[model samples]
Target chain A: MTPQLEIVIIAVIVSAACSVLGVFLILRKMAMMTDAISHTILLGIVVAFFITESLTSPLLIIGAALVGLLTVYLTEALRRTRLMAEDSSIGIVFPFLFSIAIILITKYAGNIHLDVDSVLLGELVFVPFDRLIVLGRDIGAKSLYVMGTILFIDLLYVILFYKELKLVTFDAALAAVLGFSPIAIHYSLMGLVSITAVGAFEAVGSILVIAFMIGPPVSAYMITDKLRNMLILSTLIGIINSIIGYRLSVIFDVAIAGSIATVIGITFLIVFITAPKRGMLTIINSRRRRKIEYAMASLLLHLCNHENTDREEIESNRHSIYQHLNWSKKFLEKILYKALNLNYITLNNEYLKLTPKGREYAIRCYDDIGYSI
Target chain B: MQKHVIEVEDMTVAYEEKPVLWDIDINIPKGVLMAIVGPNGAGKSTLIKAMLNLVKPISGKVLFNGLSYECQRRYIGYVPQRGSVDWDFPTSVLDVVLMGTYGKIGWIKRPGKKEKEKSLDAIKKVGMEEFVDRQISQLSGGQQQRVFLARALVQDADIYFMDEPFQGVDAKTERAIINILKELRLRGKTVIVVHHDLQTVKEYFDWVALLNTKLIQYGKVDEVFTDENLRITYGSTDRVLKGEV
Candidate 1:
C-alpha cells in the first residue's frame, strides 16, 4: 500500500476509536479531563523515551496510561480538599506535567529526531512509512496496530461495563448501594480513555486527538437522545469526517488533520441546523407556525361569536383583533389565506366565517387554553 | 423483637482532619420506616454513605445482616439525594430504573428481558408507567424523585437507603412516596430515609434516628420522638419549635 493510503486508513481507525469514547466523555462532562490526559501523556511519553531511548516502544503507551490514571487520582485527591475545585485541580496538574515534558524534550531530545513539534502536532503524513515488518512481510502501519488494540479495549470496556457505567454516570450513590462500586467503574473508564489518548497520540497528535475525541460525539449528541444511537452516530460521524477530511486535503493540497477538524466542525453546524425535532430552525419555525395558527384561530373565534357580521364591520375589526394577537398584518394574512384554502374559513370579500373544520379547531384551542389556565 | 439489619459501631467520619460525624453507634431493626433527622451539616446523608460503604469512616465498622458490607451489598438498595445527580443526563425513566438490576445481573451481563420486566414493574409501582420513555430531565422534580425510587425498588433488596427522597417534591409526591415506603415495610424490607422536615417526621416514620454530630436518639417514634430529643437534634435553643424569637 502507498504511504498516503496507510496514513488515511490509520487516521480513520484512530478517529473512530476516539469518537466512540468521546461520546461518553462529553455526555459525562469529562471532555476537559480527556484534554488533560492528552497533554499529560506527553510527559509520560518523554519519560518513557528517556528511559527506553526508543520512540517506538510500547512502554510509552503504558507510561502514558499510567500518568493519565495518576492525573485522575490526583484530581480526585485535590477535590477532597475544600481549597480547590475540580477544574482548578485539572488546571494545576496538566500544565505542570506538560511543562515538564517540554523542558525534557528541549533539554534532552531536542537535537535528536524527537522534538516538541512532532510530539505536539504529530506527523500523520509520515505514519504510513513507519510500517511494522513481521516475518519478512510488510504488515500495515505500526500505529494502526496500536490504535486498533486500544479501540478494541475501548469497545470491550464500554460493552462489558455498560450497565455499571450507565448506572454510575446517572446515579453513583445508588450504584454503590446496589453492590457496584462507582469509583471502580469511574477509574476504569478514565484509564481506558487515557489509554485511548496514548494510542491515538502518535498518529493524530495531541490537539487533533482532543478534537477527534470530543467533536464527533458532541455533534452526535446534538442529534440524538439515545445512548446506543449516540455511539453509532458518533462513530459514523468520525469516520465520515476522517474520509472527507483526507479527500479535502487531497483536493485542496492542505494539511490532512486540519481538513478533518474543519469537516467535523462543518458536520456539527449541519446537524445543529438540520436535526429533526430539536434543530434551531425547526424550533423557530414551529413557534412561528404556532403563533400564526393562534392568530387565525382567534380571528375565526371572533367571527363565530359575531355571526353574519357586515363586511365593513369585520374588516374594520380585523385590526382590533390583530392588536390583541400582537401579530404583523402580513403574518395574519398568510394564516387567513391558509385557513381559506383548507376550507377552515370562508372569506366573502371582507366578511369571514368559520367552516366546520375551523370551528372544531377553534374549540380545541379553547380546550387547551382552559386546561393551561 | 425485630432483627437488626444495620449495626454501626464507633463510626467516625471526617473530611481531612476535622470530624464531620463522630463516635456514632446505632443498631437499626429491620422492616421499619426509619427517618434520619437533624439540622443541616449534621451528617444525615453521610451516615447513609457510611452504611453503604461509599465513604470510609475514620474509625468504625458498619455491619449489614450480621455480615460485612461486601457480603451483604446485594441485599441493599440506595436512593441518593436529588441534587447528587445531573438531571440532564441522557437516560429515560426506564433506563434509570433498570440500573437497579445491575447488581443481580452482575458485571459483563446486560439487563435482559427479566430486568426490563422488573424495571417496568417498578416504574408502574411508582406511578410513572406513562413516563417510562421520557428523558429524566423532562420530568418534574417529584417525578425525578419517583424515578430514583423506582430505580431502588427494582433492586429488590432487603434494605433501602434513601437520602432526602422527599426534598423538593410536591405534597402529593411526598405522600405517594411515603405510601410506597410504608408498602416496603409491609413487605418486610427496612426503609431508611434521610429526611429534613421535622413536622412530618412524627407522621411519616415508624422509627427515628436523631443525629446532631452524635447519636441523640434511636427507637420507635413513640419512645424517641420527644421534645428533649428534638432539642438535641435541632440544637438546644428550641426557639423554632416554640415559635419564639
Candidate 2:
C-alpha cells in the first residue's frame, strides 16, 4: 500500500478506537482524565525505553498503560484528600507526572529517537514509514496494526461490559450496590484508555489522541439522546473527522494529526451550534421564546387584573401595562406583536384586551403561581 | 442464625475526624418495612451507609443475616439518592431497572430473558411500565423515584436499602412508592428507607428508627412516633412534627 493510504487508514482506525472510549469518558465526565493519561503515558514510554533499551518493545505499551493507571490512582488519591476539588486534583497530578516525562526525554534520553514534539503534537506523516512485515512480506503500517488491534480490543471490552460500563458511568453508587465494583471497572477502563492512548500517541501524538477521545463524543452527545446512539455516532464522527482531516492535511500541506484535531474541534463546534435539541442555538432560541412567552403572559394577566375593573382602568392601559411590567419598549412591542399574531390579545382603543384564549392561558399561569383572580 | 435482618453493633462514623454518627446500635427484624427518620445532619444517611458498608465507621461493624456485608452482598439492594447521579446519562428506565439483576448475572454474564422479565414485572408493579423505554432524564422527579424503586425490586434481594426515596417527589408518587414498599414487605423482603416526612411515618412504615447523630428511639411506629421523641430527635420545638402522632 502507498504511504498516503497507510497514513489515512491508521488515522481512521485510531480515531474509531479513541472515540469508542471517548463516549464513556465524556459521559463519565472524565475527559480530562484522558488528557492526563495521554500526556503522562510519555513517562511510561520513557521508563520502558530505559529498561528495555528498545522503543519498539511491547513493554513500552505496558509501561505507558501502567503510568496511565498510576495517573488515575494518583488523581483519585489527591481528590480523596478532600483538600482540593476533582478538577483541581486532576490538574495537579497529570502536570507533575508529565513534566517528569518531558525532563527524562530531554535530559536523559536525548540520544534516543523519542522526540517530545512528536509525542505531543504527533508525527502522523512519518506513520506510514513504520511498516509491519510478517514472513518477509510487507503488510501495512505498524501503527495501523496496533491501532486496529486496540480498536478491536476496545470493541470487545465495550460489548462484554456495556451494561456494567453504563451502570458505573451513570450511577457508581448503584453499580456498587449491584455487586459490581465500580472502582475495579473504572481502573480497567483507565487501563483501556491508557493502552489506546499509548497505541495512538506514536502516530497521532498525545494532544490529537485526546482530541479524538473527547471531541467526537462531545459532538455526538449534542446530537443523540440514547447511550447506544451516542456511542455509535461518536465512532462515526471520529472516522469522519479522520477522513476530513487527512484530506485537509494533504490539501494544505499541514500536519495530519493537527489537521484532524482541528477538524474534530470544528465538527464539535458545528454540532454545538446547530444540534437540534441541545445546541447553543437551540438553547438561545428557547430562551428567546420563553422571554416572549413571559411578556405575553404578563400582558394577559395585566389585562385580567383589570378585566373585572373599569374599562378605563390603569392596569389595562397599554402605556400603564408597559410601565408596570418593567419591559423595554422594543421588547414590549415585540411581545404585543407576538401576542396579537397568536390571537392571545387584541387592541381595544389604547387598552390591551385579553382574548378568551389569552384569559385561559393567564389563569393557568396564575394557577402555576398558586393564586387565583 | 440471627433473627434480625441487620445488626449494627456500636457503629460510629466520622468525616474529617468529626463524628457524623455517634455510637449506634440498631437491630432490625426480618421482613419489616422500616424508616430511618432524623433532622438534617442527624446522620440518618450515615447510619444507612454504615450498615451497607458504603461508609466506614470509626468504631463498629454491621452484620447482614449473621454474615458480613462483603460476603452477603447478593442479598442486598440499594436505591441511592436520586440527585446523586447525573440523570442525563442516556439510559432508559428499563436499562436502569435491568441493572438490578447484575448481581445475579455475575461476572462476564449478561442479564438475559429472566432478568428482563423481572425488570418488566417490577416496572409494572410500580405503574411505570408505560415509561420503560423512556430515558431516565425524561421522567419527572416522582417518576424517577419510581424507576429507582423498580430497579431495586428487580434485584430480588432479601433486603433493600433506599435513601430518601420520597424526596422531591410528588404526593402521588410518594403514595406509589409506599405501595411498592408494601408489596416488597408482603413478599417477605425487608425494606429500610431514610425518610423525613414525620406525618407519613405512622401511615407508611411498619417500624421506625428515629436517629439524631445518635439513636433516640426505635420500635413500632405507634410507640416510637410520640411527640416527645420527635422533639428530642428534632432537637427543638417540633414544628415539623406537629400532629405526626
DockQ of each: 0.46, 0.48
lDDT of 1 by residue, A1-373 (tens): 7888788888888888899889778877888898899989888888998889998888988888888998888887887776898899999988988898889989888877767776667778988778889999988888888888888888888777777777777777777777677778888888787888888877778877898999999888878777888888999999989999999989999877778888988998898898885688998999998877777767777666666555436443544545555667887778777888889887654656678898888878877774331
Where model 1 places Cα greater than 4 Å from the true spot, the runs are A282-373, B236-245
Q: Chain B, TM-score, each prediction?
A: 0.96, 0.94
lDDT of 2 by residue, B1-245 (tens): 54998988888899998889989998999999999998888898878788887777899889998889989999999999999999988878998899888888887788889899999999999999899899787788889899988888888889999999999887778888988889889999999999988778888998999998889999889888898998888866654546332
* Deviation (Å) of B23 in candidate 2: 2.9
Off by over 4 Å in 2: A368-373, B112-114, B238-245
Residues B188-230 of candidate 1 have per-residue lDDT tens digits of 9999999988788888989999897788889999999898888
For candidate 1, the lDDT comes to 0.84
Error of 1 at B186 (Å): 0.9
